[model samples]
Structure formats: C-alpha cells, structure tokens
Target: MSAEDATQGLGIDALLERERAKLDRLTPARAAAAVELQGALLVDIRYAALRERDGLIPGALVVERNELEWRMDPTGDHRAAETTDHDRLVVVVCNEGYASSLAARSLHALGLHRATDVIGGFQAWAAAGLPVTGAPNAPDGRA
Candidate 1:
C-alpha cells in the first residue's frame, strides 16, 4: 500500500491510541521516582507559555518539541548532557500528555528504545503533589 493508503482511515485519536500502546507510559509518581532514583531522564517538551504558566519539574530537561529529536538523540551532535545513550530511560512530558506520546515514538524511531511519556503529563505531575518550581500561578502556589 502507498503511504497515504496506509493511513487513509486513521484519524488523530486513533493514531494517538496506537502510539500510546507501544509505550510503557508512566504515572506521575512513578515518573518522579524514576527520575529521582532510577536515573531516568524526565524531558519537558511543553512550549514556553505553558511551561511558564504551569511551572516546571525540578530537574526535567526543557527541550522544545521541534528540537526534541536532535537534542535527545544520543548519537547526535546536538544531544543534551543527559542524552547519554540509547538505553537511557527517557520520559517525555507535554502540557497534558498527548504530544509526549508522539514525541516518545519519534525518539524510538531514532533508536532510543527506552523512550516513553508520562500518562497525564505536567498537569498530572502538579496534581500529584510532585515538586514544581516557578509556578506562582499554580492553584496552590507551589512555587
């Protein structure tokens, strides 16, 4: 089948479901623990405005969604310091989680087999009482 034929009936929701199923998506608490104890890298891909509005996880790497592939590709010259190897566990986070799943899938395409996304994204993290900084506007002002 042609490329267009392959996706002829697949809408964005279906596509999102398919991509999420291929990942071992993490909960907010588990994601925090993985980053804190298991050496996992939590990457935040939320745009600047959302990040500014929602605050940020203490150590999550902030890379734009457009730059995610290059910045997190372990073998790429533009890789981040934490983009150590293909085996590293990469947990991608977006504003509410949808984009992160797709982003993780892209990382997998780049040979990063361990890439995944948080189930509920940054909003979930903040709701779960996880640490957030610079969020003066947060409901409880966790900043």
Candidate 2:
C-alpha cells in the first residue's frame, strides 16, 4: 500500500499517539538547553531533499529515517560502532515533529532512553527565532 493508504482511516492524532507511547518529547527550548548543557546529540531525520530544500541545523547529525535505529543501538549488529559509548543524550528531528517523535522512541528502545524530539521540529525552532544554519535555499533566512 502507498504511504498515505497505509495511514488511511487513522488520523494524524492517532499516529502521533502511537508514536508518543514509545518516545520522549521535548520542546525547542528544552532541546536547545540540552544541546548546550548536556551535550545531547541532535539527529536530523529529514530526507536529503528536504535538507537541500531547507538548510539543516549547523551541528545536527544526519541519520536519515531508515538508518536511525541501526545507528543508535550499541548492541545491535547494525549499530554504528561510534555509539558504543551510549551514555549520551540523543534528540531526533524531522521536517516537522511527527516522524521524529516515533524515531526518538525507537532510539529509546535501543537504549538511548534520553532520546526525544523537538516539539515543533525545525520549523518551531526557526519560528522561535532560535539560531540555525545550512538552509541555503530557505526563504526568509530561516530553516
């Protein structure tokens, strides 16, 4: 089935609830503080096309949605070797908040219990007038 069809009949709210159950969520403000004080790893799960269409956060890691689970799980064979030291906080993000929430929860399942998503994703961060970088094509100087 097509992506839209798979989610047919189930509204966005339901999908969000399903995701929320498995994930921790944070607002843009909290995410920013976590980045500054706790050294949380920011993972942008938006597609490459989206990143090119709208710039990325300067220091955020690009883990693409498909690879997120494998990369964060230290014990999984597909886990990125670099994450063997898994004590770090991990924050996942997508274009908006929906997908990232689900992704963050998946990371939690992999042992990064601190994993969470920005409440409004990049847009919210930009809307809050927070600092951002990498959106060369973005209009209004935001990403």
Candidate 3:
C-alpha cells in the first residue's frame, strides 16, 4: 500500500491486536525491572520530533524505528559499527506502542531472542510516573 493508504486509520484496537500478536510486550513496571536488572537495552524508536515534544527516558538508546533491525543484529554486516554484541536484551519504544512492537519483532526475527517492546510505549511509561530526564531538544533532529 502507498504510505497514505497504509496510515489511513486502522482502528486502535485492530492496531493493538496486530502488535500484541507479533511482539512480546512489557508493562512499565516490568520494563522498570528489566532496566534495574540491566537485562534490557531500552531502545527509543520515536522520531526525534516526538521525543522533543515529549520527554525522553534517561539512558534509552536512540535507535530510529527504520534502522532497528540493522542496528540490533551483530551477525549481520549491516549492523551498526558501534554494536559489537548480539546477545543483549532489547526493549523498543515508540510514540504509542505499534511501531516499536513491529521493530521489536523484527529484531527477534534477526535472532535477538530477548527483544520486546514496552506495552504502552513512552506515553504509558511517562504516565506511570517513571523516571524521565533530558531537555526537550537535547537530542535534536529526527532519525
């Protein structure tokens, strides 16, 4: 489908269901535990504009959604040069949860067995009153 056609409102429930089936989702509480245990690589997949509009979670690795697969796969030559390890757990985040879920699943398909996405995305994490820091434009420019 064309970009416009693809984006044409697929009701929230339908979108959520699709995400649920493809992704391993974690609640903010669970995500917090993963962070504390240092078992997850929290990947923020939101566009830079959205992150600037909202606030960012401190320490979240900024991997844009489109580049997630390449960045997370250590065996793939396309993997980011900075990524030297493949076994790290990955928890991806998007504006809501859809895109990140998709991204996380892609990572899983790439063999990062521990990849998943936050249940409600950044909004949910923020709403849960989780620790978030950094100025609005600290990481300026979209991915």
Candidate 4:
C-alpha cells in the first residue's frame, strides 16, 4: 500500500476522538441558549449538499468546513463580519458532531478562545426543537 493508505492507520474514529479531546463541546440546548442569550455566533460547516438535503438552523452562519479557519479568523480579511470580535463565543455545527469539533479547534487556534461545537451536531439541535429554516420539519423539528 502507498503512503495514503498507511495514513488511515489511525482510522477516522480515532482521529475524531483525538480532535474532540481538545474541545469543550456544548449540548444542543446549551448551544441554542448561547446564541440567544450570550450572543454566540453559530456556524454551520456542513457542505452545501447536506444543507440542501437536511436544511439549516435559523440564524446560523453557513460557512463550509474548508473555509472555516480563514473565514473565522478575526484578523483575516476573509473573516465574516461577526468574526471581528475574537472574544465572541462561536459554536460550530457539522452533519454529525465530528467535523465540528475539528472546526472549533481550528477556531481556537485562530485565537477564538470561546470556540466550541455542538455535542451531537445539527441532528441534536433539531431534536431539541430549535428553530430551523427550510426542510427541517416545522413545529416538531423532527428531521
């Protein structure tokens, strides 16, 4: 096998756990409260396809995963308007919870001290009955 194949030795599961180990992730409800009460910025880093299929959380900024570090770096020109304050709490959400952990960690590296991820990601947020736009089941927030 080539070097690429060997790189998989750690496995995605182990890699995910490693990333999660460095994060202080928030629960879906807590994340919602943070956005509502503490002025936290919620970032949805799922791909466009996933967002199109599963819908989105209302008010959450949709930034793709690959562009997170740049778009969220307070000092970067590419940073979003909400990223101007490094002290702001940032909660990142992925399809599940894995990629969000890594994304939050990247934000931390960018001096975003309060960056974090939703524990169970978008699914949990919807399950918790938080308001979402588009296809995320209305009223009940089931899907």
Higher-ranked by lDDT: 2 or 4 = 4
Worst 10 residues of 4 by lDDT: 134-143
User: How do all models score by TM-score?
Assistant: 0.92, 0.79, 0.75, 0.85
Worst 10 residues of 3 by lDDT: 134-143
Candidate 4 local Cα displacement, residue 59, angstroms: 0.7
The sequence of per-residue lDDT tens digits that candidate 1 reaches over residues 1-143 is 36884869678898899899999999999998898899999999999998887798898999999999999988899999999999999999998899999999999999999999999899898888889988976666563
Candidates by lDDT, descending order: 1, 4, 2, 3
Best by TM-score: 1
Candidate 1, backbone clash total: 0
Q: After best superposition, candidate 2 residue 43: deviation in angstroms?
A: 0.6
Candidate 2, pairs of clashing residues: 55-134, 55-135
Clashing pairs in 4: none
lDDT of 3 by residue, 1-143 (tens): 35764879766677657656866689988888897897577889898888778877877888887787777788877776545576777788898877877787777787777788898889888878786765454344211
Q: Show model 2 residue runs off by greater than 4 Å.
A: 1-12, 21-23, 76-84, 137-142
Report the Cα RMSD per candidate.
Answer: 2.2, 5.0, 6.4, 3.7
- The local distance difference test score of model 3 is 0.77
Error (Å) of candidate 2 at residue 24 is 4.0
**Model 3, runs deviating above 4 Å:** 1-19, 77-84, 135-143
lDDT of 2 by residue, 1-143 (tens): 36875867557787678778766588888888898898888888889998887777877888889998877787878775446556788888788888898788777777787788998888887777777766685555565
In model 3, residue pairs whose N, Cα or C atoms come closer than 3 Å (at least 3 residues apart or on different chains), thus clashing, are: none
Q: Report the lDDT of model 1 for residue 48.
A: 98
CA lDDT, every prediction?
Answer: 0.92, 0.79, 0.77, 0.87
